[model samples]
Target: MRGRDRFALPILRRARRDATLTRPAVSILLPVRDEGRFLGETLASLSAQTYADFEAIVVDDGSRDASAAIAEAHARDDSRFRVVRAQRAGMVAALERGRAEAEGAFIARMDGDDVALPGRLETQLEALESEGLTACGGRIAYFPRRLVGDGGRRYERWINGLVTPEAAALDVFVECPLPHPALVVRADALAAAGGYRDCGWPEDYDLVLGLWRRGARFRNVEEVVLRWREHPDRASRTDPVFAQGAFVSCKVDHLRRSLLVGWESVVVWGAGPVGKAFARELTKHGTAVAGFVDVDPRKIGRRLYGAPVVGVEAAARFACSFALGAVAREEGRQQVRDVAAAQGRREGVDFIAVA
Candidate 1:
């Protein structure tokens, strides 16, 4: 099966029949696979959106359970809702398909197991329209409090702190500053940036980086917009594509194309695992690691990956064009930033923070 044939025939026919309907202001691209247990709740949240001028394209990616049927039932009741049945295509393909069917000026993303707060659509739309941002996201709160872990709490706090555009841009390389499901983007900008791709890493991160590369401005509404669900079956937890190594590769690839361009060699701060791993990837990408800067007295003067590990004081001696703060700890990253600033090196120009 290919293209339209991969979709349920009746659904496609209905979609074509409704082509004359008024185009919605926003299109929600939701992909579902075996999410029957939580699909209903997710759909209900969409129904509760205060911004009513939107269409929901629920792509049922070959759900073996009642996921497709549940979506169909919702479509039957709400004219704004429609379901597209796909043949087990992965998340990226499903999102692409939804994008193809979307008829809105803005495209918002939602997951089958997540809940969007009532004001999510309206607030994000206003931010994009009023502020002229290409893409917008909002803070996320993980649901089912019992399932929330230490890592989840920390991520929530870090991401929520990125209320301003500058904060998001500053720490984008450190981690995906925007929560994927809470994101809304201008349709034209999303298209220009090349929709979504499965680049052997998390698709959401790849999309954000791609938009950034295209000079798209991003902002986060300073409010919680989505109640993100955390479960053992979440792709980030179960998929190899979301692993630590994959993310490192993704970051390095984008860095090479953007910030790392024209720079022959770069210095890495932090001689720990995070720094060493990033240095190794940079070397593989043909970017030389000039040296590693560390605060530990034991590590200073030692050699790593054939590059000298120097103390912060000796960091200025290296002739590297750029530096990467590759420390994992938040405090450590801040210290790296402080040191870089004290050395008269400007952030975003002289160095970038990464994990």
Candidate 2:
């Protein structure tokens, strides 16, 4: 009872907590790396939450500096806040440890380097309630506005413009488009999926795509809830394990394991780079790829690396289980799924996952 068990109890006690301090239930989650520089401001943002009745839980992933001390300081002053230490595991493992200690009905995620807008929690909770969203994220505003370079600005615009929850399921190729550090999710849903599995470095995106496959609902609040901080040393920028190729690998592996399990022949859509790469990867794992599908008439009837590039029409001939969306665009992925459906292929069973 010294660790996770000691913390999970509040979830059971939440309903009976004092009405004076608690509001609608939530657990604010933070997994800190070497974030000593920004912890104070992050805690400031949490302390300002308009929606109360939540615990601020942080896990220090064996930082060599003041990260643990900063978190401990906050915990010392604020009974609602607690800090715990974990092995130098990756972000996903740290998130899992922190979530196990979460005592709220709803889990709200935040990054140690980012600041939440004053109404961030309230707005996300409201959207989660109204949308009946198991997972709800919101718009983001970039901080140190001058620090937002070209690539960061592009990501900001792209993520902020995602209008629908289906956008997550349909167009995940654009990276973890879910508003990082700004979403709130159902605690049970988080636990049901085994919290978060530390796999690829882009654990946030992996979790988002995973939840989509597991049938958890995600909603994007129209209002901005997080002030995303851009820095030269951001984990996505510094970590090679979080690269584009890594993202493609993560999506493909998850689809294969979950939806395409036990299939004799697997069809990969898109004859371009991603599809070809996926075919190469599957070959490494001894999975037989039936063929490739593409809308490119130039590549049609052509053989790339000995695999025939047939039009989408070829899907009817094979007993392939899933027509994986190998395309990069949202519209392109949908078109492939729609064509397969028209040909009597099911969504998850017959085909699944956008590149």
Candidate 3:
């Protein structure tokens, strides 16, 4: 964490206590990197949004293609559409530029390649204003390759199905609960997180954690707002920007910040991939692990990843944070939680889901 200035802090303070926008004005911010082919469709979706009191700020991130040309064309027709050109190639840097130039009271993040539904702005605004949530993203649908069989398809379905606040708690345990490309957030809250950082993969997940750390609520409207295109050329699908490993690293980085207690040893609750990954990140951050606990008889009483794998019973002897790294399988997690609970480990304060 870094120090914040009065300029940013004051706005955040006001937004925290005063998020009551009956008819909140919005600033639609889009960051583009060679999104020429479908930039028009994206802009058209924004144009069709039911919400009326908003302007578009498109940050052209040094596009080699005609992305800027589309922006110029859109600006020709509507004065509300604005373009900010970034000389560099950093996405976070581009987002920061857009934030600095935004004039909307509420902030909405959209990608230049993704399409927004006609009611996207209205529904997101409605939920944001009514609930006063600092962060909100609607259900996201994957278009074109909607019938594909890759795990990304399952990911899309799982993500789109999870929209409510409660579901976010569960879904975030897997990956980022709110779809990054589909979210609408309060400007003040964004300013509080020092804008967005290129911290790690799943920048959106990192941003969500930063916002949550600042005491902002995370939410999602059940209604689908954005059509996330699953093209091979997309940054998330192609570059290392939002890969699985990056997502894990990002989650652990932020999780260590918020969840790690000072010098307190952590008890990792699995010996599988997720468990080893969490242990590695925890160790990298200099957070000591009391030991690793597992139910697999073969893993028990053996050293895994240079850490002793202890039986579930051994956990009772240590007072430490338990990192539940079980993913997709909740029964084992529930059992681990049950064992921890029986030993008097409290949720949020003692045990945390790290998958």
**In model 3, which residue pairs have backbone atoms overlapping below 3 Å?**
none
Candidate 1 residue-pair clash tally: 0
Error of 2 at 105 (Å): 1.2
What's the true lDDT of residue 333 in model 3? 65
Compare the candidates by TM-score and give the number of the best one: 1
Q: Higher lDDT: candidate 2 or 3? A: 2
lDDT of each: 0.88, 0.75, 0.74
What TM-score, over all chains together, does every model reach?
Answer: 0.93, 0.79, 0.86
Judged by TM-score relative to the true structure, which candidate is superior, 1 or 2? 1
Model 1 residue 258 CA deviation in Å: 0.5
Candidate 2's displacement at residue 168, Å, is 2.8
Q: Worst 10-residue stretch by lDDT in candidate 2?
A: 1-10
Name the lDDT value of residue 45 in candidate 1.
95
lDDT value for candidate 1?
Answer: 0.88
Q: How far is candidate 1 from the true structure (C-alpha RMSD, Å)?
A: 7.1
By lDDT, is 1 or 3 better?
A: 1
Report the Cα lDDT for candidate 3.
Answer: 0.74
> How well is each residue in 86-131 modelled by candidate 3, as lDDT tens digits?
8856788888888888867778889988999887876776677666
How displaced is residue 171 in candidate 2, in Å?
A: 2.9
